[model samples]
Target: MSPEPLRSIHVVAGVISDARGRILLARRTEGRDLAGRWEFPGGKREAGETEAEALIRELQEELGITAEIGEPIINVPQQYPDKRLRLDVRRVLSWKGNPRGHEGQALAWVAPEKLPRYVMPPADRPVVAALLHPDRYLVTPSPADVDDETWLGALQRALESGVRRLQLRMPGVDAERRRRLARAAVEASQRAGVEVLINSDIGLARELGAGVHLRAAQLPELSVRPLPDAQPVAASCHTGEELRRAEDLGCDFAALGSVRETASHPGGSVLGWEGFARLREAVSLPIYAIGGLQPDHILEARQHGAQGIAAIRGLWAD
Candidate 1:
């Protein structure tokens, strides 16, 4: 017979942003699990409480403030040694009264960019990514046949369509032409205040002072991260072992999938949402659901514990 399912806790949290663009965080009280680690303020949802209702009540009880909770930002599912945690985060549209430590927890208002510096529980990390990182990661198709002008034009269009993070993936193209395209793409992405990562090319990435996205094969070949902290490093992972290695290599995020059959990988194994979530629980790195995905799937992806959706054809423009 199958073993009993692990007990799960449904917790609600709120992202309280001030006019200065800082987020409010509360330190876990001394005796709590993960004590002293900062997190978005809130608590476990009691039965019969809606996520919004739970968040509102939690804010009032923990911080002595009444919150008008807004839309859901992300729902993160994490597995611990003892139990499972489902963290539902929402936006705090507005609130009344000064936020103080009603429960004796220390309070901090941190800048969005600096949230990484403060240690947090595994479930809270993905919520931070949802708030600061883009919901789409656009991977460029090979530019081997297309002229320079046509390829760059498509890149420009993708940027205008709100692709904040990008991967310059030209797998079959020759090195020289790829470098030429990379130089131009990097220049255009920088002008638009977007971050571009080179796919499987550490030297080029270093030369261009850009980020790198490693292939799964490269995960075990390197002991240290290829780039500095200022330059992001991403990876493509297919299994929990690969995901763990990517995490060990200090990858900022990972792209996992073949979530569905696609033209590129016909009949390849598809993870489906359940498989994706299962692997997601094994690591803490923010992940993007790739393969046969489009912009419309971002909400579904996030619900399944993905950071966002990563796509080539789905995001590519003419």
Candidate 2:
């Protein structure tokens, strides 16, 4: 006989912003799991309750406010040792009355930018990313075929088109040329206020004062994070084990896919949305669905527990 499947504990959380743009957080009372940790004020979704209804009830019970729930933000699926957890977060457009912790827990309103400073539960971390990070993480096409000027010009166009996060990946390019292009890309990205990552080259990433995006093979080579916490580090993962390792190494984000077939890898196995969700359930990292995805798929990606879409051709401005 087959083994029993794991059951997921569906949890709902609300992002309630104040007039000054600060968001609310509540401390978990002692004697509870993850006690003393600060988290978005919410609770489990009881049977027969919609996500909005659950959030509304949780807010009233925990924060003493009647919330007006808004659209979905990001649904995170994470696996803890004891149980599988799904954290569904939504924006609270408005609420009635002042918010006071009704359960003897402490409450604080935090600025969106300062959210990372507060220690939160593993499942709650991705909610912070969904609130603050961009919905698209652009991975550039290899620069082997294009001239430096032409490639850089396209990159400039991508930045102008609202690409806030990017990775410079140039497979098969010579070491000298790769460094030169990375230097140029880093300069351009800094000017545009975009976060740029160098693919699989820790030395270059450090030299440029940029982030690093590790290839899957590089995960086993280093036990510690290659750069400082101030510099974002990302990874490419195909399996749950790989994703777990990436999380263990403190990768800020990850790209997982071939969610659909693409011209670049015609015969590559596709994870589709379901497969992506399955892998996403194993970790708490913000993930971008790669391969055959465009900016238009952001909503669908979010629905399947993705931070956003990561693409090369789809994002590279023609």
lDDT tens digits, residue span 1-318, model 1: 998799999999999999999999999998888999999999999999999889989999999999999988888889988789888889999999999999998999999999999999998889889988999999999888889899999999999988899999997788889999999999999999999999999999999989999999999999999999999999999999999999999999999998989998898899998899989987889999998998899989988888899999999887
Stretches > 4 Å off in candidate 2: 1-4
Cα lDDT computed for each candidate against the true fold: 0.92, 0.92
The candidate that wins on TM-score is: 1
TM-scores of the models, in the given order?
A: 0.96, 0.96
Error of 1 at 27 (Å): 0.2
TM-score of 2: 0.96
What are the runs in model 1 whose C-alpha is more than 4 Å off? Answer: 1-5
Alpha carbon lDDT of residue 259, candidate 2? 96
Which residue pairs in candidate 2 collide? Answer: none
